[model samples]
Target: MTKILIIGATGMTGKSLVAEALSNGFSVVANGRNKEKLNALKSEFSGIEVFNKDAFDLVKTDFEGIDVIIDAFATSPDQAYLQIDLAAHLIALLRNTTIRIGFILGAGSLYTDESKTQLTNDLIASDESTKPWRATPENQVYELEFLRHVKNVNWFGVSPGSNYIPGKKADNILVGNDVLLVNEQNVSVTTADTMAFKVIEEIKNNNHNQTRFTVANG
Candidate 1:
């Protein structure tokens, strides 16, 4: 069985990924900063091993037997740069190794139209209400740019659609590369379980290795 390690396993996306991974019969190692949440996850999923520590504190030894590490790390808009920092840190740690790392990114990094206009640029031109969380997509774009230049590590990235809500899996899924995805109703949203399902499917197939892709509910 592949031993998958999930960083930030207590968050919405991370927790859903954990449940999906276990449901697929893979051994899971969950890492998170909150002790209480880690205990709760461990209790909820008796098959998982919990690592209670900051993601930055994780060392190579901790991943000795892990097959893949999925980075679902998230932070406040004010400190969104940590997303890039953490991606760099993980890339540096896994350089020249066989371990594959996956990242959950924002759709802002994706292009939205025929002119190839980035969603981040569109967000920047939107109303002031988006200002509070604008830094997140901006930094996530930076994170993907940084990952694109990395040649040694095995990395993959997945971006959710405009509305990333917390919920169970959707009945259908749409996958895209670079361009934003929308369903028949012209809705661009992805539930936590749908994202998790795509992620685990990617891990099993390795179809998007060394690249990034986007997903949406269909």
Candidate 2:
């Protein structure tokens, strides 16, 4: 079995990924910074290991026997740059190794059209309500750009649709590369369950290595 460790496992996306991985019979470890939340997870989840620690403080020794590490860490909008910093830190740690790193990136990094322009530009231009929270998406774009230049670490990233909600999986899934994904109705939304399914499915398939992809409801 592949030994997997999930950072930021207390969040909606990370928790869903942990549950999906366990349901599929993988050896899973969930790491977080909150002890109370970790204990809550232990009672709800029957067979997964939990670790309480900050993601930035994790060392190579912590990942010694792990086959894959999922970087699901999140931060406040003002401190979104930590997302890119954490990506670089993990990339530096896993260089030249077979251990794969999977990142959950924002859809703002996905292209909005064939011109290859990032969706983040449109987001910044169009929405005033998102202005306060745009830093997170902007930093996520930087994270993907940084990952694209890395050649030594086995890495891949996934972007959720425009509106990523916390909910059950949809009946259908639509996946794509780089570009924003939309369903038949032209709506771009993905649930936590669908995102987790796609993530664990990618971990199992091992395709899209060193690249990023997007997913949506379709």
Identify the candidate with maximal lDDT: 1
lDDT of model number 2: 0.90
**Prediction 1 TM-score vs. true:** 0.97
Stretches of model 1 off by over 4 angstroms after superposition: none
Candidate 1 global lDDT: 0.92
Q: Which ten residues in a row have the lowest lDDT in candidate 1?
A: 116-125
lDDT of each: 0.92, 0.90
TM-score of each: 0.97, 0.96
Question: How much is the lDDT of residue 6 in candidate 1?
Answer: 98
Which stretches in model 2 have alpha-carbon errors above 4 Å? 115-118
Clashes of each: 0, 0
> Can you write out model 2's per-residue Cα lDDT over 52-144, one digit (the tens) per residue?
989888888889889999998988999999999999889988998889999999988888866786574466648888888888888898999
Q: Supply candidate 2's per-residue lDDT for 132.
A: 86
Q: How close is candidate 2 to the true structure, as a TM-score?
A: 0.96
lDDT of 1 by residue, 145-178 (tens): 9999999999999999989999989888999899
